[model samples]
Target: MRPIYRNLAGLIAFLGVWEAAVRLGLINDQYVPPASVVLTRTVELLGQEDFLRDVIASMLAWAIAMLAAIGIAVPAGLLLGSLPGLRTATTAIVEFLRPIPSVALIPLAILVIGGGPESKIALAIYASVWPILYNTIYAFTEIDPLLIDTARSCGAKRGRVLASVALPHAAPFVFTGIRMSAAVALILVVSTEFIAGASTGIGRFILDATSGGGRMDLVLAGTIVAGLLGYLVNDGLERLGGRLFRWHAATTTEAV
Candidate 1:
C-alpha cells in the first residue's frame, strides 16, 4: 500500500486501541480521556475563533522564525563553507553554541526581548538555525571535487562555478535541512509559548487549561491539534521536496 494509506491504517489502529484502553479502564480516563472525546473536542476547537487565532499566532511565529533562520543561516553557511579558514576558526564556537538547549535561553530571551511573539520568535530562530547552517556547510563539503574541477576547466568564473556546480549540488541538502528546521521551529515556537505564557498559541491554551482546572480533555485536544499541525506541515514539505528534487529521491532509494 501507499505510505498515506499505511499511515491512515496505523492511525486508525492506534486510536482504536486508545479508545478501547480508555473504555476498558486500563488507563485513567480522568487524565488521558478517550481518543474519541479528544477528537470531538478538537473539532469543537476548530470552530472557535479564539482557538483559530491561537493556531494562527503559533504558525505565524513559526514561519517568521524559520524564515529568519533560513535567511541568516544559508548565506552564512555558503560563505563560511567556501572559506575553510573561517569555518575552521568558527568550529569551536559553533560546537559550543549549537548544543545549548533553546529552552535554556527562554529566561534570557524573556528578559532581553520580553514575552509573547518576540521572545518566541527569537528562541525559535536560535533553535532552528543550527540544522540549516550545519547542513548547508556539510553540503558544500560533500560536493564532488571532480564537478568543481570540470566547471573550472570549462573556463567558468568562480561565481559561475558556484552557481552551476556548488549550488545545484547543495540544493537537496539545503531542502532536507529546511524540512528538519521547520519541525524544530514549530516545537520551539510552541514550547516558548508554553514557558513564556504568551497571550495566544496552542501551547498557551494548553497551559491555561491545565492551570485553570484539571480540564485534561481540553488539554489533550489542544495537544492533538498541535500534533496534527506538525504532521501536515512536515508531510507537505516532504511532498514539495520530492517534486522539486526527483533525482535526489531516486538516488536516495538506490543508496538505501
Candidate 2:
C-alpha cells in the first residue's frame, strides 16, 4: 500500500459513504448535496465564462493585498524589533488592535470604503499584517546572542551583521508568517465579498446559488472550488518556502 494510493483510497471511501448517506435519505441533499452532484456542478462551473472572471478578480485582490501586507509588515517589523525601546512603547497598542477581529471591521470598512474592491483589499491587508509582523518580531528576538557577539568580535558593523546574520536567521520565521498571512487573506477575501454584496467572485457565486432558490448543488460546487484554491495556495507557499530555506528544511528533517 503506497502512501499516495492509501490517501486516494481513503478519499474514495469517504466520498462513497457520503453519497450513500445522501441517497439513503439519512442526509438531506437540500442542505448538503451529494459529492456526485457537487462534482457535476463543479464541472459545469468550469465551463462558464463568468467563472474565470470571478477567479481572476479574487486572485488579483488576494495578490495585491498580500504584497501590500508583506511590503509594510517586514520593514516595519524589522525597525521595531531592532529597537527595544520602540517595541516596548508600542506593545500596548499592538496588543490592543491585534485581538480585534478583522471581520468586525467590515462594517466600518463598508461605511468608509463603500463595499467596493478596495474595501475587500483593505480588510485582507488588515487581517494579514498581524501574523507577518508578530512572526518577524519573534524571529528577531529569538536570535542567538552568542552569534551576535561572535560577529561583533570579528569586526562586523551593525549593517553587515543585520544583513548577513539577522536577516538569514529570521527568513524562516518571516516566511512562516507570510504563509499564515496567505490563509488569513483568503478568508478575508471571501468574507468581505459575501458580506459586501458584491456581484462577482467565488463568495458572490456562493451567495447567489444559496439564496437564489434551489441551487444547493451550485453552492456546494462553489465551496469545493474555494477549498481547492485555498489548498493550492497553501501548498504553493510551502513549496516556495522550502526551496528558499532549504537549510531550515534540512535541519528540521534531520531533527525528525
Candidate 3:
C-alpha cells in the first residue's frame, strides 16, 4: 500500500486498540478518554471558529519565524561557509549558544519583547535558525572542489561561481534544512503560546481545556490536531522538495 494508506491503517489499528482497552476497563477513561471520544472532539474543534482563529494565529507566528530564520541563516551560513577564517572565529560563540534550549529563553524573551506574539516569534526564530544555518554552511562547504576550480578556470569571479555552480548544488541540502527548521519553528510558536499564556494558538487552546475543569477529551483533541498539523507540514514540505530537487543527484537521508 501507499505510505498514506499504511499510515491510516496503523492509526486505525492503534485507535481500535485504545478504544477496546478503554471499553474493557484496562485503561481509565476518566483521565484518558477513548479514541472515539477524542476524535469526536477533534471534529468539533475543526468546526469551531475560535479554534480556527487560534490555528491561524499559530501559523502566522510560525511563518514569520521561519522566514526570519531563513533570511538570517542563509546569508550568514554562506559567508561563514565561504570563509574558513570567519567560521573558525565564530565557532566558539556558535557552540555556546546552540546548546541552549529555546524554552529556557522564554522568560527573558517575555521580559525583553513583552508577552505577546513578538515574544513567540523571536523565540521561534532563535530556535529555528540553527538547522538552516548549519545546512546552508554544510551545503557550501560540501561543494565539489572540481566544480569550483572549473568555474575559476573559466575566468568566473567568486560571485559568478557561487551563483551559478555553488547555489544549485547546495539548494537541495538547504531546502532539507528549511524542512527541519519549519517543524522546529512550529513547535516553538505553540510552546511559547502555551507557556507564556498567549491569547491565541493551539497550545493555548489545549491549556484552556486543561484549566477549564480538566476537559480530557478536549486536551487530547487539541493534541491530535497538533500532531495532524505537524504531519501535514512535514509531508507537504517533503513533496515540494521532491518536485523541486528532482535533479539533485543523491538519493539519501539529507534529500528529505
RMSD of each: 1.5, 2.0, 1.6
- The model with the greater TM-score, 2 or 3, is 3
Q: For model 2, how does the per-residue alpha-carbon lDDT over 46-104 read when each residue is reduced to its tens digit?
A: 88989878877887899999999999999988988898999999999999999999999
Q: Which residue pairs come into collision in candidate 3?
A: none
**Mind giving the per-residue lDDT tens digits that candidate 1 earns over 136-159?**
999899888898999999999899
Error of 1 at 37 (Å): 0.4
Model 1: lDDT equals 0.91
How high is each candidate's TM-score? 0.96, 0.94, 0.95
Q: In model 3, which runs have C-alpha deviations exceeding 4 angstroms?
A: 249-256
lDDT of 2 at 176: 93
Point to the candidate with the largest TM-score. 1
Candidate 1's error at 207, in angstroms?
1.0
Model 3 residue 57 distance off true place after TM-score fit, in angstroms: 0.6
Model 2, residue 167: C-alpha shift (Å):
0.8
Predicted structure 2, TM vs. truth: 0.94
Q: What digit string (tens of lDDT, one per residue) describes model 3 on residues 110-166?
A: 899988899999999999899998888888878889989999999999899989898
Ranking by TM-score: 1, 3, 2
